[model samples]
Target chain A: MVRVTELTNLAVDLVDVHKTYRKTVQALRGVNVQVRRGEIFGLLGPNGAGKSTLVKIMMTVVRPDKLVGTILGRPLGNRKKLALIGYLPENHRFPPYLTGEELLDYYGALAKVPKAMRRRRAAELLEWVAMSKWAKTCVGEYSKGMMQRLGLVQALLNDPQLLVLDEPTDGLDPAGRRAVRELLLRLRSEGKTIFLNSHLLSELEMVCDRVSILVNGLVARQGTLRELTEHTVEYRITTTGDLAAVKEAVERCGARIDNTVIILNGHNVAKVNELIDLLRGKGVLIESVVPHRFSLEEVFMETLGTAR
Target chain B: MQFCALIVDSLRHALDRKLFWILVAITVLVTLMMLSIGFEGGKVSLFFGLVEAEVDSYDPLAASGKARLVGVVIYGLMDFFLGWVGITLVIIATAGLFPAMMESGVIDVVLSKPISRPVLFLYKYLASMVFVLIQAVLFVGFTFLVMGLRWGVWVPGYLLCIPLLVLLFSYVYCVSVLVAVLTRSTLAVILISLGAWVVFSGVRQAPAIFDTFPELQKHHVTHQVVRAVSWIPPKTADVTYLAAKWSNAGTSLDIIPASAMEDVSAAERGQLERSNQWEKEQLEISAFSSIGSSLLFEVFVVLLAMWKFTRMDF
Candidate 1:
């Protein structure tokens, strides 16, 4: 539950967002997402799961059928407030006739950045993205990765408070992806909220402070990394003595018995101790105990399965 | 500043198209052709005096002769060439602008900017006219210079063609934008706008066509409907008369001189007389009424396009 008094602290607070395409395909259904200021929030889902649609609604690129929320303490689609926001849409195409520098200047002008500031930022961002040499090259001549780098520069031109990027690493090499990850961290450190929509679970696991998993036009799960993956932790105890002697007893203790291990499915320490004592009574020597938590990929798969 | 940026972007985009340069080349060629024709005293010389013909009434030293020369630039160059052919090519060249802007990736980034959709749409629509504006200035400027330096006749009123050309393009472009917004298809925009230009031209000329033919004028209901419907679409046909009137190029009789009419038979002279009368009546059409009504129609169409643009999902 969120208090009304905390709305100012949220960079994005969306409630009951719904969208239908062509009156047949329902893209989003009652999506509610919140991103706190200065935090990195990730939105992950499979293809056609309304992740892009939700992002588009926030950016005002797509009109929602019914949306009730505020962004950056103001209502959605507020033009003045949008100056404080920057967006890089997936598969974005810049005007090919313009050079990279000119493209940035054009978009910066549209973003309402002053002329002097636009030029300064364009130089800094191009260099920061390792694209200084390609600044004068027309976008039509650029590679996909180069275009993606320029897109990042354009997105950062206004120095927005809330940066929204969809598939920011869609067409990059390992070095480029790492650079983007580092850039996101740098932006976060500057107290700018970041909303990242991506399908790369590991990437989100590496950076996102909290994430919501969208499944079939609805949020299936929403929480921090620990909150989502910790519940499925399993404790595996390896023993020296054969586990056939205590198989039935181990099953009765709510543990599964392997040939040389007892697999405990929960975080109950007392239950594990009781199982160990029973094993010791049966003369089984415990070698090692290892606890394992599910990865984000596993958690995502499980959420998808459960949602289905 | 946002609108200026959009205009610059649009100009750069237009510059990249081959058709733009091709039009520029054509303008240069036409200007060169005009430069090659020289007038000395009462004689007209082609190819810079390589071929000369005597004409008593067309001497460049006289006021009437100078007016006729200015009439050549105003009626022949501005009206016939720039008004019809140039506008058609511009419509073809710029028809893709709105549809291209609405392409998925392109529109996504633009709409995300701080500007509202209507403002963006209106700005882009205005920016797209930079192509016509540049062409008109170059064509008229070059011809104005040729008349001043070569023929020794300077008509400053001829400069009005620049804004008048842009206004005419906007009248048709409003419809093009409406169609582009409704259907994001360049081909549809081109076909429909060209077809609409024809329809507008036909409707504009229907009254004159009826007046010229006594039989058509006899149908009272049809004549009244044609006259009423003509007020709705852009007055494209009126632009020629307006250009002639503003430039002070005089009537067809004054421009043609009495010598040219001497060879005509009585029947042909009567026909020419009625044609000249119609031209006089067209010249009498009020500039405010024509331009104001056309602008009203453009505003309505543009508002309709903006309404659809703001409501669209892209």
Candidate 2:
């Protein structure tokens, strides 16, 4: 029953994953991550933060030195379970000689997708990615954005339950990125799990239901957007009147003054109320008071700084 | 299905290269050259009768002349051209397959598939042999048709060159894959595999070289070591002789025109006899030992390479 629940609830549950390259460079160290089923889960990290390495371990492209978890309800590296997973690696290379259709058919076949189904999926996916017109064109002639789009199509050829994409928007223009973003959301709506590893925090923030920020081979933070940013709330007060009159009073209230705005850190409603009362009593004309949440980039940078 | 996909993909890759067409063109030219030579009654005609030579004792209709023709096809075309030059060209064309497959962006997607790394490695190794297989089929198949239809001299055994050439190539290609998997460098694969081929041939011929010197042959210890070491590498030099022997092309000396040897001095004739004896001795090696031992070596190298591939971080 526990196994059944895990199988239904989590698409990926990795624990104590460790990987050291050439006996020295520790790409991952005691990293634990859990991705719920049917959600777009973003894995954010700076370069060398082991985000790609962790994804590689999950996809069985790179072996982990130590790991204890289940992927799609089976032990990690399960070949049969791999059939249910689709992976679009960063900077994926398709055979230059093969046309777009052939590349899909070839990788689909490797994933053990049957011929008829591969053909059908290839057609549907090419249309979905707006690549049907270029189906017959050789991959060598494709632009980088086209290659990235084709890579996404190839990953979905098997109609995998779990989609792991590393840098899916690496070379895409804004329009292409938006299309991919929408496609990712559509896949999630259809109950497919997406484990995205990328440096594009804004992209992930728009689509991901939850995210894990990896730093120096560890998960610095892992939670939903609200859960991660809830603690980082701040209230900014904009006033038409000069705040030099009540600057000392605002500082005494643990709020800092920056230009005409008073910045109050934390989610303390009473402290914000007290600051507002003091500003009003001083006859300062309050323009607006807004509670602001930290963006994913700020969270990522903070996590990175904390990890460092 | 995955294995079939790999093979088909390999075929497509081979077709993508200019070398494949160049090889096909070479085969066509060789076939045309073979077509230009005509056998008439008791004489030989070269280049559509542009040159003719009288054979007073050699009759094209005789059994001996037919055997000579078969010998020339086996030893000259199959053994020398396909076995040496064709194999080298195919090697250069295919030595990059594994390394290319292992390229950073390429390997990640491939290795993430449902297939096991060892199986993928082995399938890829076999797929590379498809290049040699296609070349051998074309070269031998075309020559066989030309010999049967044009010359009316059919030796069905000559068809064995197809598989024989593939086997010969496998002996060297196994080393090429091992190097490619280890280094993932195309240049390293090409250079080391070609170097290994030369070393394989040299080692296989060491025992024969020892027999030429009475002093070395008399040392039982050194002779035993040389003989034992010679059995270790794939017997690449023995493949041509095996093809000639298996195809029943007769001895290498049987292909010599009797008219041409008439004016040779006694000393030269003796040297020719000695060389013929050496060729005969090479042919006398048992087919089982030659092929079996060579296959064993190939299996070892392939398994070693597969182990490296399976255990690799890629």
Give interface RMSD, per candidate.
0.7, 0.8
Residue-wise C-alpha lDDT for candidate 2, range A150-251, written one tens digit per residue: 999989999999999999999999998999998899899999999998888889899999999998999999999999998898999999968888999999
Candidate 2 DockQ score?
0.83
Q: Please list the residue runs of candidate 2 whose C-alpha ends up more than 4 Å from where it truly belongs after superposition.
A: A1-8, A242-245, B56-63, B253-274
Candidate 1 residue-wise lDDT at B37? 86
The worst-scoring run of ten residues by lDDT in candidate 2 chain A lies at A1-10
Q: How close is candidate 2 to the true structure, as a TM-score?
A: 0.95
True-contact fraction in model 1 equals: 0.91
**DockQ of all candidate complexes:** 0.84, 0.83
RMSD of each: 2.5, 2.4
| DockQ of model 1 vs. true complex | 0.84
Cα lDDT tens digits, model 1, B80-186, are: 67877888889988998999899998999898899999899989999999999999999999988998898888889889888889999999999999999999999
Best by DockQ, which number? 1
| Candidate 1 TM-score over all chains jointly | 0.95
